[model samples]
Target: MSTRVLVQQLQSLPDGPVTVSGWVETVRDQKKVQFVILRDETGAVQLVNPATRPPAEPVDPSTGSRTAEPQDAAADPAERAKRDEALALTDTISTLTTGTFLTVTGQLKHDERVKLGGVEIKVASLDVAAAALPETPIAADSAMDKRMDWRFLDLRQRRNNLIFRVQTTLEHAMRTWWIERDYIEIHSPKLMSSASESNAELFALEYFGEQTAYLAQSPQFFKQMAQSAGFGKIFEIGDVYRADPSFTSRHATEFTSVDAEISWIDSHEDVARMQEELLSFAIGAVAAKHGAEIEELFGVAVSAPTVPFPRIPLAEARDIVAARGYDIPRTDGDLDPEGERQISAHVKETYGHEFVFITDYPHEIRAFYHMRDDETGLTKSYDLLYNGVEITTGAQREHRVDILMEQAKQKGLDPEHLQFYFDFFRYGVPPHGGFGMGLARVLMLMLGESSIREVTYLFRGPTRLAP
Candidate 1:
C-alpha cells in the first residue's frame, strides 16, 4: 500500500519489508526457489520466492480426527491459507515473462552472495500488473533496422535509458549556466511564412487555400530578431525541421536545435568564446554526473573539454587537410567530411583538443546574413567540429540593412522575400551574433556514437516515419 521503493534506493536502506514495482527483466523458475530480476528506470534487483506444495487434510481441533470437507473447505484454515497463498505466488512468478509489469511486497534482505547488487527480496505476495507476450520480436543481437523497428523494446536497455538521462543533465546544465548570465529563454515558432536560412531544404505545407507555409529551417531570423528587440541575450532549445534528403549517419530530417544570440558582440570570436565556455560547463556537468555509468555502459570515458577550444581559419584548415594528403573535392571553399576529419586529427595531435572552431568561412558557403570582413571579404563565421563531425555553425550578423540586402542580392536570394527579416535591421539594431547547434550531433560525438540516429529519441529521415 505504501509508495513503491526504487531498486537503486534499496542498497542504502535498512533491510526490512518493502514494496517494489517494475517490469520483469528475467525469470529463473527453479524447483526449490524462483528468482525474478525486476527492473525499473533506475536499476534492477532480484526477487526470490520459495516453492510451496498443497496442504494436507486438516484435523479437527476438538475431535482429533479429519474434518469433513465442504465445497469451499477451510479445514485447518491458517495452514491452508498460508499454503494456498504460497502456491499462488510461486505459480504467478513462474508464469511471468520478460517485460511483465508487477509489484512485489516482501521482506528485503541484503545477501552478499547475490550477484545483483548483493541484495535480494523474499516475496510475500506478488501482483501481476500487466503480462507481456511470451516471445519478443527482437533480441540482444538484433539488427539495427529491426531494433529501430522495435525501438520501444530497444530503449528498455539500461544503456539506452542512460543516454536520455545524460542528455537531460547536459541540457539542464547549459540552461542553468545561461540563465545565471541573464540569458532569456525563447521558444521560437516552428511554422514560418518564409525560410530562416537557405531555401534549398524547406518543408512546405499548404496553409489556408492557395497559401503556402514552410517549417522554419532554423531559428536564425527570430533569434536575430531577439537582438533587434533589445533582449540583449537569448537562448532557444527547440525542434527544427529540415528536408535534407542526405542519407548520411549525421543527417536527420527533424532535430533539436540549441541556439543562442547576443547583442553588441565585437566579432565572431566573441561568439566562439561563449560557445566554448558553454560546452566546457555543459560537458563537465555530464562527466561529473554520469561518468561512471557511461563508462560502465558505453565503455567510453566522458571527456570534459577544456576552455578555449583551438581555432583555425577555414582556408588554413583546407590547406592542412590538403597537406595531410586529403584534398577536399568541393569548389565552395568548404571542408568536406574527410577534410573535417583530417583537420580534427591535426587539432588532436597539435593542440590536444577534441573540439576545433573552423573560422572565417568564405561568403559563398555561408548564409547571406553573416557579416563580411571589411578587408578579407570572408564572412565572420565559424563551424565547431566535434571529433570530426560538424556540430554547430555560428557567425556575427550584419546589422546594416543596406549591406544585408546587397549580400542577399549577391547570393541570388530575392531581397523582397526576406523583407520581414531585413525590417529587423532597418530599425536601430545593435551588432549581434549567434549559433545553431545540433543536440544529437553533440551527444553522438561525446558518446563516440557512430550515428546521430543512436542518440535521437525518434529519428526522422526522408524515407522513414512511423511509430
Candidate 2:
C-alpha cells in the first residue's frame, strides 16, 4: 500500500519501494525486458520490467530427452503461483498502449546513465487505471488544427505542460505584486444589458423575455464602476467574449482578459509605468521559477524585462517604421501588423528591449471614453507591444460626466442607452485609468509561440467550438 509519488520526487528519495502514477508516454516491449516512459504532471520517469517467458518444455529425466508437453500435476504450489503472476505481468506490459493511465509500484533507483532526471524505477507490479485505445488520434507532426482537435491528448506533451506551469507562475506573481500594493480583486458579470466597448465585436443573445443581453467584450465599464464605487485599485482575470470572425493567430472568440483599473491617475503615463513594472516583476518570477525548463522546452530564454520600457508615440513609431522602409498600409491612424513589427524591431535594435509602448493614438482610432489631451487633441492611450505583437491597450479615461457623454455621442453611441454607465461619473468619481490585456497573448509572446492557441487552454475561435 505504498502511497503514489510524483516522478519529480523520485530524485530526492533514497532507493526503496515507491509507487508512481501517470499516463504511459511510451512503451518498448523488448524480448528480454520492457521499458516504459511514464509521465506525470510534474515530470517523466523510466519504468523497467524484466520479461518473463513461458516455461520450457519438460525434460524426461529417465531418458534426458524433451517431452512434447509440460506436466503441472507435480509442480510446487507456491512456485506455480509466482510463475503464473510473472507471466501475467509480462503480458500486461506487452499490451499496454500509449496514453494508458496506470500506477506502478517499484524500487526507485538513482542511475547516472538514465537520461530522464537521472533516475529509474524497477517495477514490481502495475495496476491499470484506464487503458487507452491502441491507435492515437494525433502525431508529433500533426497540423495545428489537428492537434487542437484533440487538445486534451495533445497537452500530454512535456512542452505543453510546462507552458501552463509557466502561466501559473506568471499569474501568481502578478497577483502577489498587486495584492501587496492593496489592489482589490473583482469578478464582473459576463452578461450585460449593454456592450462594454462598442456595438462591434459583441455577442448578443436573447434574455429572459423580449430584452436582449450581450456578452461583455471586456470588463471596461465594470472596472470603471468599481473606481466610482471608491475602490482605489482593482484587478480581474476573467473570460471575455468577442464576436470577431477573424481567423488570425491572435484572435479568439472567447479569451481570458487580465484587467487592472486604478483611480487618481494623472494620465496614461501613470498606467503605462504601472503596467511595465507589473510585467517586469511577473516575468522575473517566471524566469526564476521555470527559466531552465522553459529554455530547454521552448528554446526561448525567459528573462525579466527592465522597467521604463521604451515608449514611442503612435506618429513617431510610424515614422520609425517608415525609416526602416515599411509603410503602414492602414488609413485608420493605427499601425498595421507590419508597422508594429517594424517599430518593435527598431525598439529592439535601439533600446535592446522586447517591449515598447506605442502611445498617444489619434482619437479617431481609439475608444470614445479615452481622455483627450487639451493641447494635442489626441487620445491619451497606449498599446503595449511585446516581441512585435500588441498584447495590451491602456488609457486615461474621461471621468467628467459631460465630457464622457459628449465623447459617447461623438462615437454614435446614444447617451440614453449608456445612462447607467454615465451614472458612475455623475456621482463624482476620480480621474482613473486602466488596461485590459489578453492573457494568452502575453503567454504566447513570453514562450516565443507563434500563436495564442498554443498557450490558451481551450481556444475558442470562430470555427472552433467543441472539445
Candidate 3:
C-alpha cells in the first residue's frame, strides 16, 4: 500500500515502488512491451509494462521439437499468483482508453531512453477509477463550437489547462493590488429594477406581480453609488449581461467585467493611469510566475507593458487612420474595428508599445453620465486598446445632479426612469471616475488568441448558452 503521487512529482523522487494517478493519455500496446502516456493536472509521464504472456510449450534442446506443457490449475500458488497478476496488468493496460482515470502502483525508474521527463514508471498494478467512452467527440483540430460543446473533455489538453491557470494568477494579482491599496471589493446586484446603462441591451424578466427587472449591463450605477457612500475606492470583478445580438468574435451576451471607481480624480487621465498601472502589475505578475511556460505553450512572450501607454485623442486617432487610407465606417464618430487595428499599428510603429489609450471621445458617442469638458463639449472618456482590440472603456462621471438630469434628457432618457441613479448625485457624491473592462478580451489579446471564446471558460453569446 503506497501513497498516491502526481505524475510531475515522480521525476524528483528516488527510484522505488510508488503510485501515480491520472487520466490515460495514450496507450501503446506492443507485442513485447507496452507504454502509456498518463497526464494529470501538472504534467504528463510515460508508463511502461513488459509483456507477460501465458505459459507456452517448451522447446527441446536435442531436435528443436516442442514439448507439451499444458496450463495447470494446481501449480505453485505463490508463483501462479505473481504470474496471474502480471498477466492481468498487461491485459488491463491493453484495454485502457484515452481518458480513463486510473491509479497505478509502480516502480519509478529514471531511464535515459525515456522521452517524457526522462523518467518511466514500471506499472505493477492498476486500479481503474472510471473508463471513458471509446469514441471521442472532439480533438485538437475540432471546431470551436464543437469543442465548446464537450468542454470538459476539451479542457484536458495541457494548453487549455494552462489558460485557466494563467487566468487565476492574473485575477489574484489584480485583487492583491487592489486590496493592498485599501480599495473596497463589492458585489453589486445582478438583478436591477432599472437598466444599468442603455435600455436596448437590457435582459428584462418578470420579477413579481408583473414587475419587470433587468440584468445589469454593467456595475456602472451601483459602483458609483459606492463612491457616494464614502467608499473612496472600490473594485468589482463579476458577471455583467448584454443582450446585443452580435456575431463578432469579441461580443458576448454575458461577461466578467473588472470594474474600479475612485473618488477625487481630477479627470479621466487619473483613471487611465490607474488602469495602465493595474495592467502592468497584473501582466508582470503573470510573466514572473508563468513566463517560460506561456512561451513554450502559447508561443507568445509575456511582457509587462511599460507605463504611460501611448495616448491619442479620438480626433487625432481618426485623423491618423485617415492618413493611413482607412475611413471609419461608423456614423457616430466611434472607431470601427479596422480603425482600431490601424491606429494600434501606428502606435506600435511609432511608440513600440502594445497598449494605447484613445481619449476625448465626443459626447455624442458616450454615455449620458460621462462628464463633458465645457470648452470642447467632448467627454473625458477613453477606450483602452491592446494589440489592436479595445478591452476597456473609462470616463470621469458627471457628479452634478443638475447636469446629470439635463444630460439624461438630452440623450432622450426620461429623468423619472433614471431617478434611482440620479439620486446618487443629489446626495452629494464625490467627483468620481472609473472603468469597466472585459476580462476575456484582455486575455484573448494578451495570449494572441483569435477569438474571445478561446479564453472564456464558458462562452455566452447569442447562440451559446449550454455547457
Candidate 4:
C-alpha cells in the first residue's frame, strides 16, 4: 500500500483502515482504548489503540521508526529470554520522553476532546520505528548549554518550532525579492588565502604542509570579487565562522550569513535602500505566512518595517543614548551589546520603529575597507539594529586601492599578503557597496527568541560539537 501521513488521515472514516508514522509524543492507555500522540517533522497527530490486543498481526520490519521494537513472544528458551529483554526495553519507553519514534496503522476518529490537531487515530495495527531510553539527557528547565546538549528534544518545543518556520518564510521572501530584481544569487567559498576583512580572530587550518588556510569570517571578499569580475549585483546566504569566544546569547561559532553586493552605488545610501527593502520583504513574508501562529507561540507581534528605517549617525546615536543615561561601556566607537539594546530602545521611543540604521561609524572601529566620509571623519558604514541587537554590518567599500592598502597597513596587516585582494581594486572595479547579516540573528530577534541556537538547526557553538 502507498504511504500516507497521519495528518491526511484526520478526515478519514472511522471504519476505514489508515497508516500513521511519527515519533511517539505520549501514550495514554485506559481500560478500553490506548492512545499515542504521534509527531513527525510537520506536526502532531494522535493514534489510539485498543487496550486488549486483537487477533495476531504480522510485524512489519520495514518501519522500524519507533524507539520501541516488538520481540518474539514465542521462541526457544535462550532466544525468548533475549526477546523478553527486548520487550522490556520497548516497555521502558512508555514513560515520558518525547524523541521516541513510532509508526502506527490505525483507524481515524475525529474527537472534540482531542487536545492536539482536533483528531485522533484509532491504532488498529502498529510498529515500533525507534525507541529512546526512558530518561532524556536534558530538561526543558535546563540551561541553554544543557538544552543544546539535547537539541533534538530542545527544538521540540512549539516556540522553537515557530522560530525555524519563521526563518524559512523570511528567507523565502528575501530570495523572491532578489529574484524579482534580477539579482544573481551566489555561493562563495568559505576557504580563503587572505583575510576578507582582517586576519586576527580567523580560524586557520593547515593546507597540505607548505601553506595555511583560514575559514571565511564572511562572504564579503568573494562578493566584492564578483563586483570586480563584472557581476553587477549579487547576494549570498551561507555559513560564516568566527573564532571569537563571545559568551553571549547572540554569538555562535558558526552562523548563517545573509550577504549582498552591488556595483555603481550613489553611496552607502544605495546599499541602505536595498537593506531596508530586503528586511521589509522578510518581515512581511513571515508576518503573512505565520503571523497568527507567531503571536500564539512567541507572544510577539511582527510587522514589515516601513521603508527608510530610521538612519542616525553613530555619533548622534551615541550622544542620544548617553543622554538617556546609559553610556556605552566600550572604549572603541562601536556599540556594545548593552549599548545596542539601549539604542534600539531609543529608536523605538523616538521613531516608533523596531529597526534602525546607525550609520557613519568611527573609522578606527569599523573594518579597514569601509570608505571614509572625509566631511565627518567617519567611515561610510552602518550597523543594522533590530529589536535591540545588531543584525547586520554594511558599508560602501574603499574602492581606491591606495587608500585600501593604507587602511590595511594602519590596521597592522601586511599589504603584500593581501596582494590579490588589493589587486581587485587596482583595475576596473566599480564604486560598490553591500551588507552581510546573520540570518539566525535576524530570525531570533524577529521572533523574540533568546538565542540563535533556538533557531539554527544543529547549531555549532563554543562547546557544542555533536548532535
Top model number, TM-score? 2
**Per-prediction CA RMSD (Å):** 4.4, 2.2, 2.5, 8.2
Listed per model in order, the count of residue pairs whose N, CA or C atoms clash below 3 Å is 0, 0, 0, 12
Off by over 4 Å in 3: 56-69, 72-74
The prediction achieving the highest lDDT against the true structure is: 2
Model 3 error, position 436 (Å): 0.5
Candidate 1 global TM-score: 0.95
lDDT of 2 by residue, 1-467 (tens): 88989888999999999999999999999989999999999999999999988867888899999988877643899988888888899999999999999999989999999988999999899999999999999998999999999999999999999989998999999999999999999999999999899989999899988999999999999999999999999999999999999999899999999999999999999999999999999999999999999899889998999989999999899888998998788989799988888999999999999999999999999998999999999999999999999999999999998988999999999888898999998878999999999999999999999999999999899999979
Q: Which stretches of candidate 1 lie over 4 Å from their true place?
A: 53-75
lDDT of 3 by residue, 1-467 (tens): 67888877888899999888899999999988999999999999998999887767778999899877776654899989888888898989989999999998888999888888999888888899999898899999999999999989989999989899999999999999999999999999999988887768989998986899999999999999999999999999999999999989999999999999999999999999999999999999999998999999999999999999999999999999999999898998999999999999999999999999999999989999999999999999999999999999999999999999999888888888898888888878889999999999988888889998888889999999999
Clashing residue pairs, backbone N/CA/C < 3 A, model 3:
none
Q: Model 2: runs farther than 4 Å from truth?
A: 57-67, 72-74
lDDT of candidate 1 over 101-157, digit per residue (tens): 989899999999999999999998888899999999999899877888898998999
Model 4 over residues 1-467: C-alpha lDDT tens digits? 43766464455446456676777667675555556677776678877644543224455579734444555466589976655554443343345356677666656667788788677776545566676887778776898778877887888776777777777888889999998998999999998887767877688999998899999999888898999999999999899999878778888889899999999997898999999998888799888889998899888888888988999888888898898898788888778888888889988998899999999888898888999987977888899999999988899998998888999899998988889888888778999999999988888888888888778898886777787
Badly placed stretches (over 4 Å) of model 4 are 6-15, 53-98
Rank list by lDDT: 2, 3, 1, 4
Lowest lDDT 10-residue stretch of candidate 3: 66-75
* Span of 10 residues, lowest total lDDT, candidate 1: 67-76
Query: Could you estimate the TM-score for every candidate?
Result: 0.95, 0.97, 0.96, 0.87
Deviation in angstroms for 247 in model 2? Answer: 0.6
Better candidate by TM-score, 1 or 3: 3
Scored against the true structure, residue 93 in model 2 reaches a CA lDDT of 94
